[model samples]
Target: MAPPTTTNSWQHPSPHLTRVDAFRRQVNRRYGLSLETYHELLRWSVTELEAFCRELWTFCGVVCSAPPERVAGPDDGALDRMWPRPNWFPGARLNFTENMLAAGLAAHPDAVAVSACREGGAAWRHLTWARLRDETARYAAALRSLGVGQGDRVAVVTTNSVEALLVLLACGSVGAIMSSTASDMGAKGILERYLQIRPKVLFVESRVVYNGKTHDHREKLGGVVAQLRKAVAELEVVIDVSGSSWSDGRIKSLDNFLDVRTESLRFAQVPFDHPIYILYSSGTTGPPKCIVHGGGSALLQQKKDFILGFDLGPDSTYYQYTTTGWMMWNYLISALSLGARIVLYDGSPLYPSPDYQVQLLQEQGVTHYGTSPKFLAALKQAGIKNMPPLDSLQMTLSTGAPLSAEIFEWFRSIFPSKVGLVSATGGTDLVAGIIGGSPLLPVHHGELPAPSLGMAVEIWDANGKNIEDTGEKGDLVITKPFFSMPITFWGEGGEEKYRKAYFDTFPGVWHHGDFVRKIVKTQGYEVLGRSDGVLNPGGVRFGAAELYGIVDQFSEVQDCIAVGQRRKLDADEQVLLFLKVKTPPLSDGLRDRIRTTIRKQLSSRHVPAHILEVQDIPYTMNGKRIENLVKDVVCGRTAKVGGTAANPESLEEYEKFVDLPLVQSSAKL
Candidate 1:
């Protein structure tokens, strides 16, 4: 992949940034606290934050302390040299299920935890903590009856239903590692991922609804499950949660799964490093690294993020726009530790109407509303000019991609100015944010502040040189280990490949694949974009990958590839795309779709608002379509193209048009 430039993306706002002075003024007006006083409240020493973190752990019921026996060589501090690498509760040993069970949800009695959201455009049904916990234990009993043990892996393909969340917790309680994907992924998408991590028991949902349409998993599940059974002999029972027919193991009510375990709860015990979940990234080659996070790490880090980062307390109610496939789903559910009510929507955020989310925000009294920048931009362009007052709202966290200045300004001007617009970034890799906006700081336009507490963050150049003194951009890197970082990748030869993935680049430091500036801007240093996918147009930096993800959902074309082509003589870039059409050839109608999609789905910056159509789209062997490679050829520059094509080996197919006159003009760099 080529390094980033702003051709495909960038905020048009001038470089006039709010440095330290202006930031201090915004703080005083909003919080009734000056920057100095607020800094006192926010400033944390390593020792102090560690203490607070432990308190959070205790509150969340996670029991981790250094084992009494001094395990030689790999002791707590000696385990590794990296920062934040699975700092387990150093002195205690406890079961994962026990912590969640001790949540004391009984006092809240009728307080809702898991609320079932059906795609039938129907109202939601809230599950009380009492009912939620009972159901979870019941599922645990059922899985145990099916012989699920502490070390086995239970795989699931599901939607964001109460059942899926309950099942994951159930697996954790019983010591069975949980791995799953959203029901919306296609056959190849699901199959390629599931095949790598052979789950012992498979849970498949029959169907899920998005927008106004319903999609069934029957076609893919049958073939996919068949293949999974072939790989893992331990694969025995199956649970179908879709509420539809076509099952392998006697159709079990997701509700009934809990019924079989009528006895008093029986939780299991495992090591601190026991695997909990297997999350995947959108990479092609070498087996989708099944990122394995530990039970201890997941619980503690989650508690830290919810309580500290977002100011989520026991009384707070939370909801984020997410699906089962996204990491936010996992993060959202963990907030249950705070005893806060979590509102889940299974259908598209804009399904039925664009006003759906605003309605939820007002009705649910959602204190922490997390969503993507794309969604907010869509709301703006869709003429959703006004919204129900979020009187009870405390924070609005935006992730999934960078928040453009226009989208950010819209919130400041049109949305609730009292509430903070927290643009946070963390991926499935760390299971937490490297740098996220905290309530303690003022929200700036299109930038984030300091790293989450305890995250030892630094930015490094290609040769592993640290970019100090703030304001300089470089590859975002983590200097030390912290809890919640993936312990390993499943199905790998060993930790060898896992280590190679993040460590090989900068030797000992963990090189996170993001191009960021460690600027001591108003708040602090923040990450910029995917270092590998940043689009450079002139001198601006933009995240092209995020731009594509937001723009593709516009429905103007079936799919699109946005790449910034570099010209030798010019100091700028030309943005191009290889689009696949579901409708007819490029016409005014199609162009309108492209423009509207970007404007409605994202801000004008992402619209590409300029596009091109190519006969064939080139992709890597693993199905990842490469945009940088195409851009390289589009600039009339020689690329690795001269070599054997990665996938669709028909290099000739690309050459036929890669240097074509029509294409050249469309993407003249």
Candidate 2:
């Protein structure tokens, strides 16, 4: 049997929606519907939206084609086939990293560019628009000599440093494929991703600076290098940034690698669809899919999210808590396109103390910030105080999973009322957000501003048909293929897997696999919990947020996970509720009350038949709950759990729980 159903102890459908106007109508018209879904940024003509996109593309040198609305079989008529084929800037050429680098340095040259601090009381490093550009050029010249030519792959096992940015942009300047894994990941984890790409040159740090201390990365990195040597025949140059001692045949200090380069070298330019970076999926669904992004598509999407979505500009200074392995690090680095400073941190946001990152924000007066809800939740739990006043901040962005309203309100409460949360959403595949907050839109407590300017986002029923009911829950689907869609799966030719992953579920549409709702709730705006992660028992459904609210309210329950456990004998599976709390000889009355409260609040059907206690809940290395991963584990599947994911040992406890006698009794429930 799989687990039973349980919702959060705090969430429910909110009825607070604002009055609608022409803006709402215009929003629907552009995205393929005129439904009264609540949210700001609904007002504006499709022309206005198109105008926004065109300026953005021109500004960032991103090439785009029309949305994927008009795809036809290969043999379709000329106008129909060729017209809708791929509308990118077919005749134009540009560099992917150039756009991001240009944004912060070249185009908008006078921006307050970057400020970085490694650990407690470390010397701060700041870079202006002009300085960052020159550094990138130096690195570009350096990498070009290492044979990082167009179409070649360069991988990095490193930390968050300016050199990392230099390397990414340098590779882009010459059209080399860029791949990176964060420093903390185990050697095996780094090898898994790198082996797939079979990179020609690797840039690795001998060590990493974190939490005011240095860790010897070489111990694990050496193992990784030896493995790569066995798998890839072409892997040659190894650029060591640690300045550590090494005499391997292929290894050389980055200093010497860059020493042979000249000052006046030319940067390589490529066609719009040229591959520039390789990013893997979250692997919650299955094996990580290696999605290859083109220079043009990445530039457009990154520019759209950073510039218009976050209201970034020459005056903007952006901060996002992220790393090389996670997509946000890639997304955050694109703020360079806005000609804004990029704040990159290598330590925990709450390191040395609960207010670690908050101090940085206060010290720097960040203009724009992006982070995850899991990070914010930890801040709340730690009771950190007087976070640097983000008075200079224009917007805050959150992504990775559904950001609860509780978190939204908590963050807003700390800042002024005018401060808005962008509620960003997207992944490594798109290279940025598909939906983000808008400055022009009146702020909503938890909803994203609107669908991305040119993206055709829709809520679809199980059959892949559009759902008209405002509050009806459905799968999030794209009626048209947006420009940011992956060109093709990396290491594979053509679009077979691309089509299979996004289009096979539906005949013509792209399925995003998120059970979600696009709605204009109580205030004409709402960002709801994931519907795909819903808990259903006997066909009665409840979202994770809804169940979490009820069970977690128990003082004894520190944290919990709610999942629908499939039963072999019964058509309707049971709701398996796992609670992670302090073990105790607590009152049985308290446990009874917890279950009773859920039955009363949701329904008897919503109550989990079996509520088992565990020592801790498993979370990805990033701190978010690993729902599907744990779900896969309970079902006896072998998953390549990544090294970067945190506290994997907690997952082992969950595995051990199955042997406990309590599980059999819960099974009958």
Candidate 3:
């Protein structure tokens, strides 16, 4: 890999004092070996997988009713034992909610466990650990009275509020699996997912506040519950969180749903692989797939990432801006395992003021902040400047999409010099980060610091040969399974569908679908883009991120999406680049400059055949550009524009480009 430029390197202020360094010392003393560097520790983690997991389990203080006899699977083979679906800590018994509550209460029962607020609402409402435990106890008792028990599914459609967190914990306390989606999602999208799981109880928010609007979902909720009751005979109860009166007699308000007669909490100690969460695949191109995750694996892996990777502790305050729809919400919830205070916001960060989130960071004294590249770019676009130092903010993590080098510099330019900017990559498939930050590593521009420990991450060519050392872009694959792999998919033929989705691409290895390369010099990785959406024009393949990074430098472009288009009758694929500009009428001068910069920075092959301007770019609910969906539209294919899209109507504008004269001429026989 080429060396990081002088401007690209951001050195860590204090490496030795980091939690990873402290862990390294513990590892050295216990293992009777000297592993000096972060890279060396990472190597030992993947190679001695069992030892590393055992160490991590003890270090994180995982609260369990019964400890496992061994850290590896029961078959005594950590690798090649049923391959991808193998279990970890086979004989262990634990309760997910118990662990989180224990850690929180152990720190201090009176401390704030959650601080939540809404857009255009009153000041933050703090929920102490004692109050959180009480709420969970009451909810669990109510669930039990409703016949919810071990293995039952409880679904929630709510905002990122204290009530949602309480419902999740209550479900975990009873060993009932929990699945949730944000209230902003249309009823159809919500039904499509909940229908597959057939949850026993449903929790729906009556009102939602977003983008400076209060959306009342009374009619929508009635229609959804009516449909769900008809289809799912097992779905017996509906609870309204916002206390709005509903016409359906089956719906009960939060005050009415709770069992006032009961007060104590009882945690169900189930097996190690007991299912706790059911997440869905982003169904941009098709129906969303339901993925089930286990309690033990989710607890161990996420705690490792939060405590070790981000160096979070009991005194730290973590604020991850997310909705219930995204996996980051689950990751954020896991912060409680460290007894750390967490901030939960339900509406747009841009509302009230442009720098509202920055102000929250300073006010909350957040030690770790989780966000995306889009928000940072918006700050720069809004001309936000001269931010005072936040002495409490230690690290800022960006993950929804790839963070550009310019954004990295922009973060450095705005934040305090001591704050480390982490550009990490992971997805919903695992419900955790595969490659993220480490306090011991330097922040290189446009690169993630390292692969998460015990992930066994590597880059593989089309033939499944490891090419990570070659410094060549390839598929990001996991040669060995880690703790957080999904336990199973939720319904009929689910296992087959799951296998086909991930393992079918490369047989046994976990194909993560990201196009990336290893920066050998810095021991970091540059995530190019999704491998499936790679653009191939003239038989030369490259990631759209390469083109986007250059085009983003242009002041005229506000947002963009690059995709390859090939009609059914066409022999060759052509590249189409769409731009959303700040000003109207994209001038020829700006287009020529964009093309010139792309051609100069990248090869001519990387340049798009058509540079068109559009009013908006389609994005998923999670803030990812819908490139594949756009590709389908421009190629004249019928696309399934589902509720996963944040703005599905934006797809209509791309249909006009199907029969462009240049594109028609470029199509070879």
Candidate 4:
């Protein structure tokens, strides 16, 4: 296989002025060595992992009460082999909230820390650093008054708004573990997650507006609280952020619940390994796993990512289009720790117009914007060209799904050439990116430029052999331990379960479950798709993203899903491609054109046995294609549609294809 010959699109104007470059100089001074290039720094970072973490903590300006006893504890050979889990920063005492708010409050109390807005391009509401600190104190005092304290769990079913972030910080201030999901999730979905942790206090929104529709969720909230109380014996209070009536005795309105008199803020210092947040896995196929994260590691990793990975500083304004449920929300708010203002937006990005987000970015003077590939696809399909010249924009990031080559080229055509487009790949498992952008490097089209500084990212074959330099697709594995690894999955046998989920595949290394191939010529990596979702048609393995990358070039494709199917009578799995076509519906000519292109570009072995048209495609709430669910339905297995789905009903259309004549005929081969 040959790498594409496309030139790098964007490069830093002054690399020496960037934060990462400054940090590199600081490291060189401390170590008394000269390391010039980014790749050299990367090699040193992974080889001396503990020293790299120590340097990150110092350079990132972490606010701590006590210094760490040691940089990091010794690794027990394999990551899964350790009996007692090793902590990253041993004997350190710090508060996550203090680290997030202290620097901003100290430097400029009057500066805007948060700019909040809702759908329809509403007027932005700004919260200054001083006000945010004061409000967080009051909320923390209120939580203490309600008997919530350190090690206790506080959950929320809320929208992405100012009040929600206030409660999150307040919980962190008092050393309580915070867990949250989006308001759009149904009662069953929310309960499925919250019931596992059994939080002492639950905060929920009364109403949510999206796509210009206001939905009153009072009835649903009442039912959810009722069921929650029955199962969760620790449940004590349910506070509604929005002003809404509640008949339940445990429920309290926000105004009544808040303690307004207290104005002084205090941060409870906990050990380095103390739990800060509990995030859940997508429950598409089964029950969601409750993953707990440590404060010190989360803070260090996020700060490193922001300061070095994206070159964010105090002057930068950051906005990430996300919901409360996604990890990007947590990632977005971390910008405040660097004295940068973060935008908290609620509701749909497409409301009113497709270009509303661009208008908001222009109005707010956002330098760094984080978004998903789905949003870019929407803008492309809507024919949004002639975009206003966004002079203030510096970088645009894409995650949540693979950024196809076509979308990458289209994005370059629309946005300013000076604005770098970064395609990053990571997971909610780690609250930071594994392979993300570098300020010193040039931005390449459709490829992740570099591995995250502290992450030892590599590709491995089925035999556990390192295949990164071969340009052949393999499983993405972390060969060493990093700070941001989750503390543990929350439950009995959590350590064992965590090991099984990440380490069982390779017996030592952390198998990230992503199929990837490193581009040998450019040293950039391309995420193919989920390793578990890899298509194995007639014993040839490949990711669905490879097929989508080719099919997406066609203007007729609105959306598509490719999966491998095998029935009880079939001899081998056959590849099936389902297309959600735009107006002229998928004609035989168009199908032949797609098939011919796939056979020509990729080999004949890569072509799908059938190209069927569908009315719609299913996606998760985070705008990811639910390939596993579709594969399950088409294989004649019952699909256990979970709460993570944005549109589960769209899956019913795929049920008829279970007994496809073409699939049955493949068995005769």
Kindly give the number of clashing pairs for every candidate. 27, 46, 0, 0
Clashes of 2: 46
lDDT of each: 0.64, 0.64, 0.86, 0.86
Cα RMSD to native, each candidate?
8.6, 6.9, 2.5, 2.8
TM-score, every prediction: 0.78, 0.84, 0.97, 0.96
lDDT of 4 at 582: 87
Cα error, residue 115 of model 4, in Å, equals 0.2
Task: Indicate whether candidate 1 or candidate 4 has the larger lDDT.
Answer: 4
Tens digits of lDDT, candidate 2, 1-669: 212212211111111221122334444565665544333343232224443344345444442233222222234332222123354555555666666665454456655566766765375787776777777788888877666799899998777777788888888888888888788876756776777788999999877777657888776878889899999998988888878887575678878888964675345777766887888865543346678888776776777666555656666678888878887877777777666777988776666875777677767878777788767666766666665555676567778766665566676666554455656667666787666555434445555556665566677777767773476666667665455678777666436767777777776666776666555452222333455566666665556656665653454656777765553344555566787765554346766887798778856666676677777677655556777656555544554576545666777766643332222222234
Model 2, CA-based lDDT: 0.64
Which residue segments of model 3 deviate by more than 4 Å?
1-6, 81-84, 662-669
Candidate 3 lDDT, 1-669, residue by residue in tens:
222224566666777877788889999999998998888999999888878988998888988878987876657776543355776886788999998889889879999999998874455799999999988999999999988999999999999998899989999999999999989888778888998999999999988878888889888878888899999999988999998877677788899998467869999999878999999999776568999999888988889898778999899999999999999999999899899999998898788765888888888889999999888888878866557578899889998998988888877777776788899998899889999888777779899989888888989988889999989889999887788888889999999988987898888888989999998888789898999898877777778888878876877788999999999877778899999999979999999998888878876777788999999999998899999899999999888877689899999999999986444322222
Off by over 4 Å in 4: 1-8, 74-84, 662-669
Give the residue spans of candidate 2 off by over 4 A: 1-87, 103-112, 247-249, 284-287, 520-532, 549-558, 567-570, 582-604, 636-644, 656-669
lDDT of 1 at 539: 45
Q: Kindly report which residue pairs in candidate 4 clash with one another.
A: none
Q: What is the lDDT of residue 196 in candidate 2?
A: 76
Clashing pairs for model 3 are none
Displacement of the residue 529 alpha carbon in candidate 4, Å: 0.2
